[model samples]
Target: MRLPLISAFGLALFSLQQVAGITPPPGAESLTACSDVSVRKEIRSLSSDEWNTYKSAVEGAKGDRWIDWFGYLHERVSTKIHGNSEFFLYHRKFISDYEKILRGYEPNVVLPYWNNMIDYQNPAGSPILGEKYFGGNGVTDKCVSSGIANSWNFTYLGNECLQRNFGEADTIVTWYSPEFITSILQSSTTYADLRAGIENSLHGIVHLSIGGDMNTMHSPADPIFWLHHSNIDRLYAQWQAVEPDTRTYMYDGKDYAGNDVTLDDKLTYTSTPAYEVMRLGYGNMCYTYDTIQTANGDENALLSKRQRKCKPRPSKATQTIQKLPAKVLADFYPSFNKKKFSALENEMSDITPKQPMAADCSKPFTPPKPSEKMRGKMPYPGTLSKEYIKMMNLNSEEVRSAEKRAFAMIDELNAANYLSPYLFDLE
Candidate 1:
C-alpha cells in the first residue's frame, strides 16, 4: 500500500500565516537586533524552574490556539519547505517564530529539543513519552491519556484530540542512531547532502512513528512537533558550526521545480528571505542549541564533539566475548531486519544476547557497511513513496541514495555492536 506522507488536511491557509507574527516577516516589518540569545537544550536536561517556565508558556499558547494555528499554517506550507534546500532555512524561521510566542508569556523561556537519537532502540519506552512529559501511545481508540497534551483539543480542520499512533504492530520502529547521525554530520560537506541525509532518515521516521496528528502536514498541533523540529534545527546549526568560515552561510540544493536554490529564496508562507535566517545568533534567528554552544573557547565545534568522542570502546568481556552472528542478531534484534525477520526472541529482545559471537578484539572494527540484506530493511514507517516524492518535490533518486547511506550507517553500528548511548544499563 502506498503511504500518504503528506497531511490528510492540507487545506491551504494563506490567511493563517498572518496569525504567527511574533516576529514579523522580512518584507513588511523592519528587523530588530536581538540583544539576548536563547539557548535551546535537550528536554531531559531542563531544570525544574526551566521546565515549568517552558510548560507554562506552551500552555498559554495552546490556550490561545496558537498551537492549532501553527498546525493549520504548516498544513498549508509543509510541501514548500520539505524535500528541498528550504528545509533547513524555512524550519529555522518557523520554529523561532513559535519560540517568540512562547517567550511572549515568559521572555526567558526557550524551546527544548528531545535528543531522539539515543532513544532510537525503544522510542516507546523513552521517558519523554511518559505522562510527566509528552505522554505515551493512546489507549481507548488511540486517544492520549497522559502528558501535557493529553486533554488538548484543536479546532483547526475540525476539533480532534491529540493522538500518537506508533508504527509496526502498534509500536514505534527503531529510529536513526547518534552514530549514524554523527556520520551524516561529519561526512556531509555540502548543504544538499546534509539536507538529503536528514530529511530522508530520522526526520521522517520520528514523524511517522508518532502517528496521528504527527503523521500529517498539520503536525504542529502536537507539542512534539516543536521539540522534534528543534532537534532538527540543532543538527543543522551543528553542521554549520563544523566549518564556521565556509558552511555557516552555505545554502545550495534544488527546489521543488528542480531549479538550484539560493540564499535569496523566499519562504513560501512568511515571504521571508532565506538569507535572513542563514546564521543563528543575529536578527530574528537568535537562538543556539546546547550542542552547538561553545565549549572552552572552541567557537566552531559542536559541544557533542568537543566534550565526548563518538568512538565507543567495548568492555573487556565484550572484546574477549564473541560477537553476535548475523542470523542470531536478526532474530534477537528486530530493528536489524524490521518486519521481515522472525521475532523469535521477542521476550528477551533487549536484554538477552542469544548465541553471542566470539570476541575478536584483534580484528579492527569495520566502518558502517550496510549489506544488501541490511539495505533492504528500514523502518516501515519511514517510507517516502512516489506520491510523496511528487508532492514534496523530492527527487526520487536522491531519496533512494539517502536511504542507502542511512541504512549503511545502521549496518555499521550493528557490525560494531554499538550500544546506544541513550539506553540505560541494568546490572
Candidate 2:
C-alpha cells in the first residue's frame, strides 16, 4: 500500500530535524541545523537532577509539548531523509544528538534493567519495580498475580527492561533477543521465517499471552530496548559503510508476505497522516550506509577490508563458528547461519551474495484477500476491503485518497527540511 501524506504543519515540524550537507530544496537550510550531536550527548548523560529538570519542563502547562517534539522527531527519522547520504549524513546526527544528551548528564547511568525473564534466581527487589508495581511479590509464583508479565506487551519495556512499575519510573528485567542483529542476518538469509519457526516450535514465551514471538511485542517501555535499537541503528550505519550498494532490503517490491510493498509503502498510515509513527518508527526512509569502520577504528573505510586482517585462526571444532564480530551477544548470533552455513559458504564461493532486489514490475500486481483471523486487526488499516471499510464508518476510496494526501505531504516535508537535524557537513 502507498503511504499517506502529511499536513503542511507536520511537514514543517519534520523539517526542523534534518541536517544534510548536500544542497536540499529551498529552505532546507533550516533542516541542516536540527540533528545536533550536543543535544544527543546531553540526553545520554541526563542525571536524576537533569531528569528532574526535564520533568519540570514537562510538568508545566507546555510540558506535553516536549513529548510532541519527540514524537515529531521520531516521524522525521522514520519517513523522510531517504537514501544513504541522508541516512548517514543526517539521521545519524539526530541519534547522536539524543545520545549526547543522554550521556551529558551521566555517562555511566545505563538503563538498569533488560528483558523480564533474565536469571531471576536472585531477583533484585526494588520499591518501584517488581511484582509490587504489578501487584505481585517479586517471586516467580507471585509475578503473574501482579499482572507485570504480558502487561506491557509490545512496549519497549518488553524488548529491553523487563520490570514494570505502572506509571512510575519502575523497571522490569526479562530475556529477549536483539532485533537489529536479526535484521542484518535476515537480510541475507530467511531469518524471519526461521524466527517464526523457532517461536512456533517453542510455543511462544513461557507465560506471556501477548505476542507469540519476542519480536512482535517490542516497545519503548523497556529502557534497554532503546539502547539495543540504538546499537542496531549503529549497525545499520556500519552496514551502510561496508555494503554501499545495499541501501534498500526489499525484494520483488513485496514484503515478506509477498504483498507489494515499497520502502515508502511502509511509511504511510491508512487513516491518519502518521506523523507520530514517523517520529518513532524509522521503518521507511531513504538512506545509504555510513562510512565503514576499519580495523584501526577509522570510520569511512571498507569494513570487509578491516575484516580481512582481523580474520580468525581456524579451529578444528566440528561445529562451524560463524564469526560474530560485534561486541553485543545479540549482535553475534545472526552473523552465521547455523542451519545452512555449509550451503551458504558453497554459494558464496560461486556467487557474490546480493541482497534481494526490488520486484519485477513488468508483471501485474494482484490484490490478495485478507485472512479470516486478520479481519478485525490488520497491520495497515487499509488492508481490508469495502466491507471492512463500511464497518469502520468510512469509504475505501476516501481512505485511499486521504492516504494519498498524507504521502504527498510527507514527501513535501522531507523536501522542505523537516529533517534538518539529521544532516551534517561531511567535511
Candidate 3:
C-alpha cells in the first residue's frame, strides 16, 4: 500500500503548529531539551557565508587591542568548558536565539573556519599565522605554535593568557587574591569595581576566541563563540530581572581604552543594539540556572520565588541542596566560585556616578568621584609595556593598512562557500 503524501506548504504549517504548542515540562525548562522549538529551527536555517562574515567582523581587527583579546578568550574558554552538556545546553538555546536575529537581517552569516596551524607546525600553512601577522617583532615559529593553543585553553584561563600578554599579571593576581574575592563577595568593594574586573576578564575571553593578532579575521577556529557569547548576554539579561535597584547596580558607568561604556549603553551582536540582539535571538529566551539557596529561613520564600524564575530545581539524580548552592555560605566552600559565580551580579561602573540630567545645555557635566580604594596607588597589571607598544604601534598608517587587509581577507572568505555547515548544526 502506498502512503499519501502531504504538500510542502501543508507540512511546514503542521510543523509550525507543533512547535507553537511545545512547552517545557515542569522543572525541565533549564535543560537543553526545553529550549523553544522555533528558535532552534531558526538557527538551523542560517546560511554559511552569513555566519562567517559575522565571525570575521568580530575576529578582524579595527579598534582597541582588548577587542581582539575578548574574541580570542571566547574561543579558548568555550572550547575548554563546553564539554559539560549542563551548561552547554543553555548555550545551545542561546545560540539558537542569537543567530535568529542575525539571520533575520543578514541571512548569509555563517561560522568562521577554525585554524590550527601550530598543531601542524608550518609557518607557510596558516594564511594569517605568522610573526608579522600580529605586527610583533621576531616571534619564532615555535612560540607562535605553542602560544596559539596555550593561549586558547578557554574557560577562565583564556582570559589569563590575555592578562599575561597585556602585562596585567600583577593586577590579576592582586584581584585574584583571597582578600579581593572576599571584598567583592561581601559587597564592601562596591559593585562598580566588581563589574570593571569582570568585563576586563571576559574581554580577554573574546580576544582569545578571535585571535591575539589583528590580521586574522574569520579563520576556521571554533564556531561556538557566537552561542557562547549569547549565553553571556543571557546572563546579563537575567541580572536585569533581579530588581529595579539591582538593574541600576552599576549605574555609575566606566571608561576603558578610549571608550566609555555606560549602563544605559547597549551591547550588540553585530554593531546593533543589545535589545535588538535579544529580539533577534527570539522574542523570548528561556534559561534556567544551576540553582540558588538562601541563608536566612525568613528570606527563603522570597529567594525561592526568584530561584524558580531563573534556575532549575534539583533533579532526582542530585540532591536538592547540592543543586541549590547557598550564596551566603560561599566562604565555606571555595569550589562554588571557581565552577560558577557565587553571586552573579552585572558589571559595575568605574567612573563617578552621573546625576540626573537637566534640560539646560549650559549645565556642566560632573563626573562621579573615585572611591577611596580606587584613589590609592592602583596597580597596572595587564597594560602593554612601552617596548611592546612601540613594537606593535610602529607606524599608525601601517597598522591601519594591516587592519584593512584583514577585513578584505574576511570578505573573500564570505564570498566563498566556507561557513555554511556551522551556522545551524550545534556540533
Candidate 4:
C-alpha cells in the first residue's frame, strides 16, 4: 500500500514541529501560518500611528521590568554567545522573545529595525537618532537627554539613566555602507563565513562607534540595541531566504570555547533549541522584513504603504553623499585611498551621482560641531578622525597578527569571567 503524499507546506510544518520541537499553541493551527503573519518594517518606515504604538510599548515595558529582563539576560549570556556560531541564532531568538514581550503590552506593536548602513556616512544626523526617536548621543554624565527614553531609569544599574556617547569625539564616524553590506551578503556562502563577516566587521564597528553602555555586555540597556539587532536579524533572514532549502537548517561553526555547534545546541537561559530559531517565519519566528518580502514577490505593496506614510525624508547630506561619484567622493573625502576606492567601486557597481553635483562641493567641506555642552563630553581628546579605511587596507600579515592579539584578549576575559574587578560600581 502506497502512503499519501503531502504538500511542501505540509512537509515543512511537520518538520518544524518534529525536528525543531515547535508545537503551535492550542487553536493556533486555525490561525495564520507563521510565514503569513505580521511584517516587521524598518524604523524609518513606521507610520505615525505605528511609531506611537511602538514607542508606547517600549515606555510601558520600562515600567513593567521588560527592559531589565533583557539587560539581565545580556549580562548573563554576553561572553558565551558573542564571537561564536551562536551569535546570530541566539540573538534572533532573543529579539523575537523581546518582540513577544512588547506585544504583551500592545498587540499591534512590532519591533522595527534600524538599517544603520543607510546612515553610515553621518550616523548622528539620521532622523532615527533624533530627539523624537532614540535621541542624540549622551549629554552630561553620558545620560541620554532626549528622545522617548530620556526619562527612563534602570533599576538593575542602581536606577541610573540610559546613556550613549555617539562617537569618540564630538563628531560621529562613518560605518559600513549598504554597498559593503551587499558584498558581505553575496560573498559569504556558509553560516560561519557570514557570521564572521558580520560579527567582526559590521557588528563590532557599530558597537565601537556608538560607545557608552552600547560598548558593554549589558548593551541591551539602551533601546537602540533592539533596533540594531533587529536589522542584524533581518540580514540573517535575508541570507537564509537566498537559499532557503539548504540554509534554513544549516548550523556549522564553533563556539567561543572551540566546540562544534549543532542544531540541538540550546540557547543560553532558554529551553529553546538553536535549530528552531534558525529559520524565520517558523516556530517562534512569525515575521519577515520588507526587503525579504519584496524579494519573495509581493511587489513590496506592504512596504510601499508604510513608505508613503512613515519614511523620513532623506537629509541633504545623505542625498549628496549617496549621489557623489567615486572619484569625486574620494576627492571630497580624503579617507579613500587607491585600494579602498577600488573596493568601494566593486561594491557599488551601479552608483551614479546626481547631475551637476551640489554647489557645496566647490569648497572644502566642514562637518558641523557639537553644542558647547556636548564639547566637554566628547569621549576622545583630539579632533574626530576617520580610521576605518586605513584599517581595512592592512596587509595580510598585519591582519593575522591582530587576530592573534584579539584571541589572546578573549582568552584573558574567558579565564577571569566575574573574577575580574568591577570596572564601575553597579550598585
Candidate 5:
C-alpha cells in the first residue's frame, strides 16, 4: 500500500534514463499492476515461429560476437554476483540485458524460460535436449553438434565450441522437484535464505548436470543458459510477489565481501540499485512470468491475454508447487512459522493472503504419480568441485542443509505418491 522508499540517487538515475531517451521497458512501472507486463512463457509452449525466430536471433548474435561477450561478462563478474545476496538481483539484470540484445536481433523475440524441473524424471530424455531444442551431450570432442548451438564456434576462452558433457553417460542426475522448490518459497523468510536454497539446489545441480560451460562461470556462452536463468529469475520474482507488500524492496543477507547487503547497494557490473529490481513490472523490470501473472492474480474467466490454448497451465493437483503446506514448511524449518514470521510484523500490519503460484487448472485435478522408472531415483546432486565451492564462496553446511531439505521433501512426496506440478504435463 506504500510506495517503495527508493534512494535519492535511484530517483536521479531514473530521471536521467527518461531524459536520455532510453525507452522504458514494455510495461508501465507499477509493481502491483502486471496488466501490461511483457509475458515470458515456458520453453515448450513457444510456437514453431517463435522458436525459429529465437534461433535466428541467437545465431545472429553469435555471428556478431554478442554470445562471446556475454560469456566473458559472466566470467568477469562471477565472483561479484554469485554466492551472495547479489545472486538474484545480478542475474535478473544480466538476463534482462541479454534479452534486450536478443530483441536487437529479432525485435519480436521475448525470451522464454526452460522449467527444467519438469525434466528431472530423466533429464536427458526430455524433448528440450532433442534436435528441436538445445542439443544434449557433446561428442567425445565435447563439441555440441546438434540443436540450436550445433557447430557453434566461439572465441571466449580461446576458440571454444559450445560444450555439454551430461553428468552420467549422457544422463543428468535427478534435480529438485516442485515440492522442494515449494518449500523454499514458503519457508525462506529472508533474501539470503532464499538465495542459498536456490543457488545451492536446483540452480547449481542443473549446471553441474549439464556440465561444460554450464558448469563454468562462462555459462552464458550456451544458448540454454538464458532460458535457464530466466526460469530462475521467474522463481525469484514469484517469491517476491507472494507477499509484495512487505517482500518487495526486501533485501538482506551478506555480500561476497562478507558485508551486510542493503537495498541501496549497487548491483555488480551495473550502476542499478538493488531496490529497483526488487519487484517485477516496475522500474526497468518490464516483464512478468506467466506463472507470476497467475501468482500475481490473473483472472481466468476473463482470461489474461497472455494465456494460450497451446500452452499448458498448472494442474490443480500441483498447487503445492507454490508453497508446501504450512505444516510441512514448519516441520522443515521451525523458524519459518507462518504465524510467527511476517515481513510486516514490526509494522503491526496483518498478514494478507498470499498470491497463487500458478494458473488455475482447466483440467481435472488428479495427482498423477511418477512412473515406475522414476520412482526412488530422486537423488541429491553430487559434490561440487572444491574450486566451484570456493569460487562461489558457498557455505558447505548450508548447501548440505538444502540437500537435506530436498531429500526430506522428496521422501514426503513419494510417500504420499504425489506427482509434482512440474512433471504433471509429462505424465
Candidate 6:
C-alpha cells in the first residue's frame, strides 16, 4: 500500500518541530514549554531582590550535599570536558544540573550569567565583582572576604573560605569581545569549530582572569564558576539559535580518548546521553537564555513590566529629513562645484545655515594624550603574549594529566561505588 504524500511545507514544519523538540497544541500558533524556558539574565542586570535571592541560594547550598556533589563532579570531569569536543555540550549539561540544585533550595532562583564581554576592557572594574555582588579579588591567604561567599565556609576542601584572586593588582584582564564572539557564532559550522573557539578564548580567559578556585579543578567551589559557565552556555545556546535547523541536534567532536564524539556518548556522572543535552527545551535540557527567547520572538520571555514597556513601538511621526546646505554638499560632491551650487545654497541657507565651529574643533584634532593612569604598568595576564600563551599551553597539558588522574581515581571509586551519591541518572 502506498503511503500518503506529505507536502514539502508540512514536511519542513514537521522537521523544525522535531529539531526544536516542541510541538504546539492544536489551535495554538506558537507554544513555548513553560518548564523549558530558562531566562538567564546578566549578573549586573539582576535586581536587588533577585541578587539577594541568588546569593542566599548559593549560600544555602554550601552545607547541602549539592555543594560536594558539584565540587566532586568538577574534580572528576574537568579534564575530560575541557579541550575536547564535549566542551560545550558537557558544560551545558553541567550548568543545567547546577541550576537544578540551586532551584531545589530557592525555587524561584535561576542562575544569572556573567557576560564577561561587557567587562572585556576592564574586568576588574565591573560591578559584578564589587562588594555588592560576587565581591572583588581575595585578600590575605587568597581567601574571599566579600560578596555571596564572604562569610560562607566550605567543608569539602578543608573548610576554607571561597577565594578569588584577580590575576594582578590594579590591572584588569582583557576578555573576549562580543564582536569576536559574534564572528565565532557566524563562522563556526560544525560543533568542533565552535567548541574550540569558545573553550580556548573566552572560556580560558575568564577562569585565568578570576585566578583562584576558578583556575583549579574544583572551580565550581567558586560561585563565579556557575556564572561564567552560564554565560558560556548562553553563547552556545545563542549560536544554536542562529541556525536551529542544523545546530539543535548537532554533535561532532572528539572525546578525551581521541575517539569521535557522538550524541549517544554519556555525560560523566549522569545517565543522560550527550545528544539529549545538545538540544535545548528537550530531555534534561529545559532552559533557554533570555537573549535566545527574545531572538525567537517569545513575548512571554519579557519578564518585568519595565521590559514589556521597552518593546519596540512604531514611531508616531516619520523622521524628518534634514537637507544639508548646498555649500556643505559642494564639499562632498565636488562635481557640483561651489559656484554652480551658490543659487541652491542661497535658496536653503536660512533653514540649513552652518553654526560657527568650536575653536578647538578647527585645531588639528590632536587626540588627548594617554594619561599614565590610563596605562597599565604590566601586560594583562590574559593577553595572548608569548609567556601567557605558553602558560595556557602548559595549563592544557596539566588539564590532561589531571583528567588522567581523575579517571584512575574514578575507576577506583566506581569499584567501591563511592560516586553513588554524586551520580544522578538524569534522563
Provide the TM-score for each candidate, comma-separated.
Answer: 0.72, 0.30, 0.28, 0.68, 0.78, 0.67
Say which candidate scores most in lDDT: 5
Taking all chains together, the TM-score of candidate 1 against the true structure is 0.72
TM-score, predicted candidate 3 vs. hidden true structure: 0.28
lDDT of 5 by residue, 279-312 (tens): 6655667676656444323424223344343123
lDDT of 2 by residue, 1-427 (tens): 1112233343334333221222332322232222211111112123334344432332331222322333345443433332111222232344334433443444422221112221111122322223322223222312223422323222222322233222112222221212212333334332222222222211122112121121223222222233333433443433322222232231122232345433233332222121212222122222221111121132223223433343222222112123322222222234343333322111111111011111123432222222333222211111223543342233345345433432343343333323211112222
Ranking by TM-score: 5, 1, 4, 6, 2, 3
- lDDT of the candidates, in the order given: 0.63, 0.27, 0.28, 0.60, 0.66, 0.57
Clashes of each: 7, 88, 48, 0, 0, 0
Could you give the candidate ranking by lDDT, starting with the highest?
Answer: 5, 1, 4, 6, 3, 2
Greater lDDT among 1 and 5 belongs to: 5
- Model 3 local distance difference test score: 0.28
lDDT of 3 at 276: 25
Query: How good is model 5 by TM-score?
Result: 0.78
> Which stretches of candidate 4 lie above 4 Å from their native place?
1-32, 303-427
- Candidate 1 residue lDDT tens string, 1-427: 1101112121112112212223333442344434555567677645456677888999999999999889989888877788888898888888989998988988778888887875666688777888778888877667788988877888875677888787666567777765456556655779998899888877877887788788788889889999999988888877665555567667788886679987667887666787688766556776665544432132233222412332223222222112445553343333333432111111111211111121123432332222234321333225555655665556788778777766655555456554433334322
How far does residue 229 in candidate 6 sit from its true spot (Å)? 0.4
Candidate 2 regions exceeding 4 Å error are: 1-174, 177-244, 248-258, 270-427
Writing each residue's lDDT as its tens digit, candidate 4 over 203-222 gives: 76676577777767788888
How close to the true structure is residue 191 of candidate 4, measured as C-alpha lDDT? 90
lDDT of 3 by residue, 31-101 (tens): 23222222110111122333244534433321223243454443443332221111222333345444444
Per-residue lDDT, model 2, residue 309, is: 43
Lowest-sum lDDT 10-residue window in model 5: 346-355
Assess candidate 2 and give its lDDT: 0.27
Clashing pairs in 5: none
RMSD of each: 13.8, 20.1, 22.1, 13.7, 8.8, 18.3
Query: Candidate 2: deviation at residue 312, Å?
Result: 26
> In model 2, what is the error at residue 111, expressed in angstroms?
12
In candidate 4, position 368 carries an lDDT of 34
